[model samples]
Target chain A: MSGVSENRVLAGSPSTGEAARGGLIADVPRRALILLGLFAALLLVAPATVGDYLLSVMILVLYYAYLGLAWNVMMGFAGQFSLGHALYIGLGGYTAGALFVHYGLPPWFGMVVGAAVAAVMGGVIGALGFRFGVKGVYFALLTIAFAEFTRILFDHWGWVGASSGLYLPVEYRDTDDLWLLRGSATMFYYVILAMTAGAFILCHWLLQRRVGYYWQAIREDQEAAQTLGIDVFRYKMIAVMLSAAMTAIGGVFYAFYYNNLYPETIFSMHRSIELMLGVIIGGIGTLFGPILGAIVLTTLGEMLTGLTEDLGLDGIKQMSYGVALLVIIVYRPGGLWPWLRRRLGLEKPR
Target chain B: MPIDFLLNILVAGLLTGLVYGLMALGLSAIFGVMKVVNFAHGDMMVVAMYATYTLYTAAGLEPVAALPLVAAGLFVFGFALQRGLVNRFINATEHMQFLLLLGVAMVITNGTLMVFGPDARNVQLDYAFDSYNVGPLIVDKVRVIAAGVAGGTALLLAAFFRFTVTGKAIRACADNFTGAQVVGLHVNHLYAVTFGIGAACVGVAGTLLLLITDVHPHLSTDYTLLGFIIVILGGLGSLGGALLGGVLVGLSEALSGALIAPSLKSMFSFGLLILVLLLRPQGLLGKQA
Candidate 1:
């Protein structure tokens, strides 16, 4: 497998191994860390200078980055292509929102509950799908069916406001309530940043672990992974559960940060596609690819919307996105990040 | 309560199944010929529907009357798309190809959204509302014609595949691409031709559907999902499988709607899909994995 060869090269080189084995080592890419730190610092401080609209866009980028990373774990790493990841996100949002609305539970607690529910749901889907040996596009369709089913069911159920949507009561004083996750734009920015950071760390850690190696093996060739006694099913399930849990947290962040939850909006297939667009256009199965993709795509989307508003070329956003996807698939199927990595001499040829 | 009601449901189920079968035919053909699940099948149907609608509204022609032109146009379109766009990713991994198709589907759908807008349009025919009473059961004339058209198309497709040289070549290519290539078959042309046929089937289905229902840009998602379910249920590349699966799904939907709530209709089909996947895995009529 390609990843196996890449892994051997990365781990086999003693100098690189020593650098990667420890934090802040001399062999580590100091420029990359410095750039990342600089970016983080800018992100943290930008809300002060940026307007509400820009902050909103930033929030979307962070959200997409977070969701993309979560999705990448199952899809890019574990080779499970799920089309219904919005199921976890929607479930997470709804669970937390419903708990808050009905039981008046604090959002921090509700978030945990939401993540747990998503994890369980992921487990069920994983067990049923993997146990029955539903592979490839069939498994993807299965996930879509389940997600759509849940969406329809939730759309019908009125307790959490159903299709009408659930709105978080806007209390002026509640903005200061960190427990409820209610805050101003700056606070929300920091919160989403922290969440994005957490997701990135989790993904990085997982990618560096033994389980990551197993996942790569399974992804590259399931039969080979099985022959190597990698317990494909278990690892796949673990990836699903972890991915779901992370996505559920994103859902919670969405609900609280946005202060609204709509079945159609949260659980829509469009949302799933949006989540995938970032990863696909950036680079699937690569660390930080989703983040870069999210940033680029979101920025482009915002720019397109702005252009439409200014120049009045309606529907250009969708057209541009279509064109972008086509161009990427045709010219650089591995996506912009991988292409950039090669161009910049960051990625060595096999 | 009455026999007529049951008969009406049965008739409705059969007609619906025919439409489903037509939709699945294209998907099945693409899958069989190229081993590619054309997720854009539904979008192609949507595009055909839009074309039919445009012809109907602007040219003042009946959708059924416009079927041939629309089918021919879409045949060209599908051929061009497959040859120009899809052929590039044929050598890529299955996952990449799937994503590529998905991206293409997205482009088609969003492009439709841009051109047609999100408003729903119906191909208004004078005969749409005209129905006949067969004893106690009321049968819509349009639906009956649609069923007949669908069945005829399916039969014609079956015959074409069985008898035509290009069709045989397509089948050979599908069965073994490398072997067929070695045997002097033009695999690329065959693929484009198969995709064109698939798109043509969707065109026919779209025109017929316009006779009974409305068309929307987003309706492709539902059709895609339904076609996917039927294809899976029928076995991926089997025409007979698609037909049987479509009928089964249509009947199940009808019965479930009759026995349960209308809202739970899709849930029933989904549940059946899960059960089938668990038990058979190869689908009811699919070849062994």
Candidate 2:
């Protein structure tokens, strides 16, 4: 019964949504594959060409891109705005880091548990919000409340080092330890690059599947989808849970990469906002949009820093970021990806 | 807990809540009229505080003395903001609106930091340590003055909205956007006026706040969240509700701080916000959706 409805939804929407997808599927698969191969090859050898500082910047860009992809699953695809997504990142990072720090467990083992925990957290938020018929901004507020409440709880909970912070043992090794997940910056960079690629593929596959169609239908109109026999509560829950789980994996990487976690910084609203900025500025719900956004935003931010540093300005870089964001949002509400597609004559102009 | 000790906490909460009520009122007013959440609500208030600070440092003027001047400045600022930037996005999606205001918030915060740096700033007040003793209850003089001033502004705001022609016109617009347009109301001007009033209210609130607490650019986000929580608790559009909600939070925070760890006070406040949101989202005095 559900299968028939899923097919109906799939057949019904994307025939039109395909155009709105920023011309992702409009491209020939062969061209996309070639481009993907070239992009991946360049990233693989990027460490050799770029200096350590540039490599670090690239890592940040990719890291945020990974988070943006994870966040896009719930927000962009499903049309559920989560203002407190930092909660998932903090939870996953802390859970995995704590397990590794306290019990000497490998991060791979810890990440599984971390992802599960984040999924459950996401589920709880979904159940409470969706069941009560909270929609749009109200739902966003609910997420923020839960995230802040959790942050405060963690702030006082002595188990995770309370407000002081959680730190892991630093191992300066020349060789990469894949099992322990401790290694050089190059190793970490490769790991994150691989993760970013995986996230994009996973999103693409999900969009092709039945669930993705249901999500797009729901995002377009919840009531209409419900009238069509789609289970609204369940699909929304799945999106939230899956997104949370993926973000937690990023969290595990963040904990190991930073070697320390503070509830203050990790669970901050600023972090939540920063992660999604790329998605909004690039192309929302588009697979390659976040990657491009990450690259543009990070590079722009670096350039601004260079300009601001000579003048020794305290917050000018941030002000420029704010100004830049406004300009992009005002000029390209459909995001840079769709705009780029039009410029390259790959997609029709809106 | 001893009764006097409890009363002391209660008094403290009430004092803090009065100021919070005024701040939330500013946010609620803008939201009520425009139906758009001012994400930069708190940052604008912080800007008002800086205005007050400038008046103090440059001319040795008291915040009380500079209140009207700062509020007028904020009114102009808010008016320009709504007319220039926010007006373009009124018809846009909610996501775009949020992003736009978040951008505004970032610019305001960073710009303030660029000019003032990160250090906390304060004024040297003559009545800083003075207190009033009534029987067994002791209250700080500065807090009482701040609270009193905040309460007065809220009253003035309520009266303005209730009695003034422009205020009624704004309310009519809130009641029905298209009808107001059909009736030939200059909605854009009214919107700018409503936004200016909201900003001016925050100016009043921020000035009073500076009388009691120190000011910095980063404190604005906390205020923004606090305002939202209060407005939600009191009900979204109700002027009276915002005050009630503010008092509730203030009392709860005071109680939690005394009963639990001081750091966990915000946990209780957020907990109440969640409960209110989940259980009775219309808020204590809000109209049903």
Candidate 3:
């Protein structure tokens, strides 16, 4: 089946032993290490040098990169595709936003609740979905159903502003509120950058462990993984929980950064698709793929937006993205990262 | 629970549910043969609505009168889409199928938005807003006609699938692609025809929808999701199941909108879908594959 082989293509060249033998950093090729260092340096310095407008764009790129990495843990490594990831984002954002607005609680504390709620939601979905043996496209549809249900429920909820939408009051402050997570563009950029870095390191560490191998095995062939006594259900649940909770953190960051929440916008299928594009474009299972994808997609989208606006051609950007997705699926199914990996001789066939 | 009120809801649900059934029938048939979820289905419906609206506005034809032309146009478009774009990825991964469909959906919706703008347009006839009383219960005149048309289409589709050689071939292909190929069935042609028929069903629905409501670029996404729920509830690849599932969903939606909040109608359907998936993964009327 194509499902089995797509994961095989990802797990093909990289032998697990290399990544497991030390930390991810310890086993990295020297060139990749150098590139990682250079990239880190660039991220650290960009906020300082870039203008406010560009800083905002950088923040969005980092935000997507962070979300993509979290999602990659589930879809890429674990081979569980969730098409309704906006559930976590919407839940997490609403939880944190409601707390701040209603109770005057800071975002730091609110993020804990946000992540917890999302993890619980993930746990329920995984439990119900996996226990019943819903897999593949059916599983994806199940996730969409849950997200749409939640979105509709939230739209009718009064405490969260119903369909009118919830907006946090903008108290103009010159300085960044570090604890409260209220800040200017530069401050938010650094925060998102740190989050992206944290996610990368955490994912790298996780992928080097037994759980990562179990996930790959389960993803590749569930029956085979079960034959080897891999406890397939538990590992898949772990992936879901981990991915959901991490994405919730992104939701919290998004809430504070944007200072608004809407059931339609936050929980829309459009949001979920936008979140997954980076990983799909960059590379699904590769560690650095989401990062590269986030940068490439966000940059291209912004450029297209600017160009289309200048030319008075509305919706050209969205059409381009759709066309791009179709083209990529048809011609470049392995995505940019895998192609680059082969071209650079980073992953040679055994 | 006034008897008349409940009866009115039941009547309305059955009428609208017939439309939903026809829409889901097309979706189910497409999945039956192709094993691909057509995410662009709703967008195609919207396109049909726009086409019908254009015909009605330009030619001064009634909305319902423009149904055949729109259905033919969409059938050709669906046939071309399958023969050209989707055929290449028919054997690809399930993930690829979803991405391809989603991409097509995005392109169609955005392209329509670009061309038509975000404004909602509707074709209004004198009888559209009128209602009729049959004894104690009242029913909308437009809904009655829509229900009749949808039911007629479904019956015609069922008869075609049951009696025609092409329909048998399409079903055979759905049952087993390689087996059908070995049996000398042109699987590709059947696929194109099945997709075309599905799109044609949506065309009929789009035309009917223009009578009671408005059309916009994003109108079809709601229908798309509804179609998915109906298909799943009826059982994937089961035509009759989609019809029954659509009725069940339509009835629940109507009842909920009447008794509970109108906004929660879709939520109710989604909850039912999740419940069904958890309890009966094979669907209510669907046989286990």
Candidate 4:
């Protein structure tokens, strides 16, 4: 009944066998260094070369890239597909924003508190959901339900300002308030860039470790992985916890950077879908795919919006995105980054 | 609570449950026969609603009068979509197929949004607001009619599956695709016809829904979630399960809203889903995995 033999047949074939073989250490490290250098250079040069609109777009790209990486840790690497990822982001934003507004806590400390709260929430949901044998689409639905529940709860709760929304005091004059993270878009852009880099490195390190291998095995075949003595529940819970914590950080960044938090907007299914879109369009399991996806999607979105506005066509951007998604899935299911990597002779042939 | 209030809630809940059951029937039929979860099922319903709405507005016909045309139109639309597009990925992994359906849903939703913008529309039948007396209770005439229509459709569907050759072939294919193929069943045509039946069910449900509530482009998500929950609760591939599950959910929602708060209605349903999944992974009427 279990498709273990089918999996073996599919995985052991030579076409995929090459993919399973880890690259040479020299080539891997060299590629890693090149990517790192390129990123650092972009960070330093982007602010000067790009205008305000482009800078804001870059910020969004970086934010989404960070989110995509965070989500991939759970969904792609660990094979736990969560459709309610906005729960973490919403929780994180509300935590930090509420604390900053109510208690006068600095954004830095607020961010940590937010992340911790999100991780704990993730742990509880993951524990309950996994323990109850909710997997696959059921698990996805559960996550969505939880997120929606949270949104509704927050919508009526006035302590977090309810549906009217919460606004952080923006004192542009206090540009040097690094602790509170109140500054120009340029300053916040750098902060997000730094966070994105840190998250990327963290995910790369995690994926290279034993836990990563355990996750992949579990994802590919949970029953077989369990038969091999792997603690599937523990690894999955950890993946969720880590992913939630990381997503919370992104939420905190979103709150302070935007200086606004709306339950409907932040905790929306749309935000979750947007994050997943980055992962899907980039490449699910690949290390660099999320960032690539975020950049490409953000750029394409901007272009589409501009084109629609220029042509005086309403709702064309969304339609274009839908068409793009269809074309991408039908033609290049492996995602753009992996396809490009294969084509460029940078990675081993599929 | 007053006795009349309780009775009213109960009646309303039962009627809504019947309608939900009708909607779930399409999903259940498709799943039962094809083993594919059609995420776009709700969108098809939306399409039917739009078609019905257009007929009501343009032709000045009542929703009930437009039902047959809408159902037939949707049946053809669904048959073509499934035969032309979805069948290509029937052999793909379930996860990939889910994604594909999600993509299809997005395309449909966006296309509708582009066409209609973001406004709610309702089919205004003069008699929709009418009421009827049933013994000591007064009920909305439209709701009673919708429920009757839904039950009749279910009965007719049951008969079709029991008495018709193509319907039996569909059931046979659902039981085992490979065996059905080896036994000389036209698997492809059966699949398409099964989908067409499902779509027709949704079309009927959509027309029925327009009698009681407003329709909008975004209504698809709420209906999709509700249908999925009902189908899952009823078990994956059982028509009776869908019917029973829909009634249960509808009753719970109504009772919860009457007893607790209106905002907690969705939460109650979700809680029930989790509890049922935990206690009986196979669902109330589901076969053991």
List of chain B TM-scores, one per candidate: 0.96, 0.97, 0.97, 0.97
- Counting clashing residue pairs in each candidate, in order, gives 0, 0, 0, 0
Ranked candidates, highest DockQ first = 3, 2, 1, 4
Candidate 4, A334: how far from true, in Å? 1.2
lDDT of 3 at B27: 92
Can you write out model 3's per-residue Cα lDDT over B41-63, one digit (the tens) per residue? 89998998888888888899887
Which segments of model 4 are wrong by more than 4 Å?
Answer: A1-32, A174-176, A310-315, A348-350
Pairs clashing within candidate 3 = none
Candidate achieving the largest DockQ: 3
State, as a TM-score between 0 and 1, how close model 4 is to the true structure: 0.93
Runs with alpha carbons beyond 4 Å of true place in candidate 1? A1-21, A24-27, A310-315, A342-350
Candidates 2 and 3 compared by DockQ, better number: 3
What tens-digit string does per-residue lDDT give for candidate 3 at A4-56?
A: 24433333335657656755566566666776799799889997788887888
Worst 10 residues of 1 chain B by lDDT: B91-100
TM-score for each model: 0.95, 0.95, 0.96, 0.93
- Interface RMSD, model 3, angstroms: 1.8
Whose lDDT is greatest here? Answer: 3
Give the alpha-carbon lDDT of every model.
0.82, 0.86, 0.86, 0.82
lDDT of 4 by residue, A1-350 (tens): 11111121111223332333553232243554676578789777899999999999999999999999999889878888888899999999999999999999987888889999999989988998899888777778778778877887788789999989999997648455678888888888889998998888787666656687788889888999999999999999999999999999999999998888998889877688778887777877777778988988888888988867765545565556566666666666667776766565455323
True-vs-predicted CA distance for residue B107, candidate 3, Å: 0.6
Mark the regions of model 3 whose C-alpha exceeds 4 Å error after superposition.
Answer: A1-21, A310-314, A348-350
- Tens-digit per-residue lDDT, A15-125, candidate 1: 443434664233324455666688889988898898999999999999999999999989888889899999999989998988998889987888899999999999999
Ranking by lDDT: 3, 2, 1, 4
